[model samples]
Target: MPSDGFRGLVYGDWHFLEETTSKSKDSHVSSNYAYSMGIALRGAHYKVYPELKYDSVKPMLFQKHAAMSINLRNTQPMMLQNVQMKAVITKQGVFSQKRIFSVNNSKIAPNSIVTLPVQWQFDELKPGKYKVQVQVKGENDWNKLPMTWKFIKNIKVDKKAADNINDKIMRKPINKWFYISMATGGLMLISLVELLKLLLTGSK
Candidate 1:
C-alpha cells in the first residue's frame, strides 16, 4: 500500500467507507429531515462502513450494516434543544425503515461524539449498487449531510444464503407443506366416497 509508488489502485471489487456532516447552520437548517433532529454547526458527524456479509447464497438478501456513533456533545455547552440523529437505507430512490436516537434529555459536553450501535436487517435489496444516508435533525433546524456507499452483490454467507432458511419477511406467508397436506386429504376423502357409492350401487 505505497501511496508514492502507486498513485491509486482503482478496482471494481473495492469501496471506501465514507463520512459526511453538515457544513453550516444554514445547511443544517435547510435539510427538511436533518433540521428536525436538533443539530449544530461543528459537533455532529456521521460515518458509514461495511459491517459484514449477511449471507452466502443469493448474498444480496441481506448485509450487516451500522452507522457512526452519535454523541450528545455535538450540542456543546448548551444542552440539546430537541436534537436527535437518524439512519436509513434506500434503493433506487425509495427510503426504508429508520433508526433514531436522541440527546436532548442527556447531559453532554461540547465536542464529544456519541455512538449508537445499529445491528439492522434489510430485505428486498436487489443485487447492485445502493446508497445509505444518515440525517441529523434539530427541533428548530435541520442538519443534512449525506454519506453514500457502494454495495456489491457477490457472495452470501451460509446462514443467509440458504433458500430454506426462514427470514423475517418469509415467515408470514402460508406454508407450502400445509397446502399439500390439505390437497392430499381432500383427494383421499373423495376416493373413499366414490368407493362407498360404487359398493352401494352394486348391492342394489
Candidate 2:
C-alpha cells in the first residue's frame, strides 16, 4: 500500500488520467486537455514485474562486492520491447551515500522471464540498514503505452564483515621489488666471490 498523496484524487492510489490532443495552427500548436472525474481510467496494463530473489530478511555482509539477483517476467500476450531495469540503494537515513545499478535495453518474450545482472559494492557504505529500490519498465510492441513496476527490499550490513574488509583494505601493500633487488644483489656477490677464488687458484 502506497498512497497517491492527500488532496489528490482522494480515492487513494488513483490519479486522474488526462488525455491531451494537440493540433498545429500556423507555427503554433494548440492543445486540448480532456478529463472526466467520474470516468474510471484504466491505467496502462502492466504485464511485467520484477522478482528479486535473496534472503532479504537476514543481515548481509558488507563485502567489497555484492549482487542482487533479479528476474524480469513478462506475462503479456505479446512480447515486451525496450525493457530495462534500474536499481538504487540508499542509506535509510543518510542521503550522502548512494549506489545505483542499471540493466541495459533488452527484450523479453511473452510469458517469459529474463534474468538481470545487478551488482553493487558496499566497500564505502557504513554498517547500517539500507533499502534496495528497483524499478522495471517497458512497452508492449502493440500497445503504444509504457508500463512500470517497482519493488523494494530491506537489508542490513554486518558490522563484523565490514570491519574485516576495511582492515584488509587499509593494510599496507607488500613491496615485491625490494625482495627481487635483494635476490639479485646476493647472486652477484656470490658470483664475485667465486671469480676471486678461481683467480687465486689459477695464479697459484
Candidate 3:
C-alpha cells in the first residue's frame, strides 16, 4: 500500500471478505509485514529469466558457410513475446558482420524450449579462432525495462577453409554503422545436402 503497486482483494477459503497479507517465503507473523514484503520485493528482479545455448553441427569449420543451432528456453513466470536473436561474427575481438534471426514462433509459452537452426555465412574469416556472439531479447508489455541475454562461441578454421574464404573476401569491408542501420531479415539457411551438391558441381 505504501509503494506504487496494485490493490489486492481477499481470496481464500473463508466466506468473509478481507485484505490479503503474507507470511511469505518462510517468515513469522510476529515479525510484522515489512519483513515479508522486503524479502519478496528484493527477489523481484530474479523472477524473470531465460536460458540460452549455442551449438554448431560442424564445429570445426572447413569453408565459408557453416551450420549451427541455438537452444532457447523460457524459464520464467510470464510468456515471452516476440523473442528474437541477433548473431555476429567477430575476429580479433571486432565484429566483421551481423545477422538477425527471427524465431519460428513469436510467442514462447512459459517453460517451453525452442531450438533454432542457424545458418552462418562468412566468407572472409581467416584460419583462426573467430567468435560467434548471439544476443536474445524478450519483448512483453509487462517488461518495463529491456530484457536481453548474450552468449558467445568460438569456431576454428583449418588452412583449407582459410584459403577458400581468402579467395572470396571482398576488397572493402562493410561499414559497421551501415550494417546496424540496415536491419532486415536478410539471413537465409540452405540445407547441407544442397551445399554438398553445389560444392560437387563447382568441382566439375
- What are the TM-scores, per candidate, against the unseen true structure? 0.27, 0.40, 0.35
lDDT of 2 by residue, 1-204 (tens): 224322111111234555456655665655555554432122244333322233232223323344434555554435556877787777677454676768757755554555543444434336777777777777755554676777777777678755554554333458999999999999999999999999999999
Q: List candidate 2 segments past 4 Å from native.
A: 1-64, 75-78, 93-96, 115-117, 121-127, 157-204
> How many residue pairs clash in model 1?
24
Ranking by lDDT: 2, 3, 1
Candidate 1 lDDT (Cα, whole model)? 0.35
Candidate 1: stretches off by over 4 Å: 1-78, 84-86, 93-127, 139-204
Whole-model Cα lDDT of every candidate shown, in order:
0.35, 0.56, 0.50
Q: Which lDDT tens digits does candidate 3 get at residues 54-102? A: 4342222333354334556655444555666666555444545443445
lDDT per residue as tens, model 1, 108-148? 22333444333333323233233344444432112223222
RMSD for each of the candidates: 19.6, 19.1, 21.7
lDDT of 2 at 23: 53
lDDT, model 3: 0.50
| Native-to-model Cα distance after best TM-score fit, residue 74 in candidate 2, in Å | 3.8
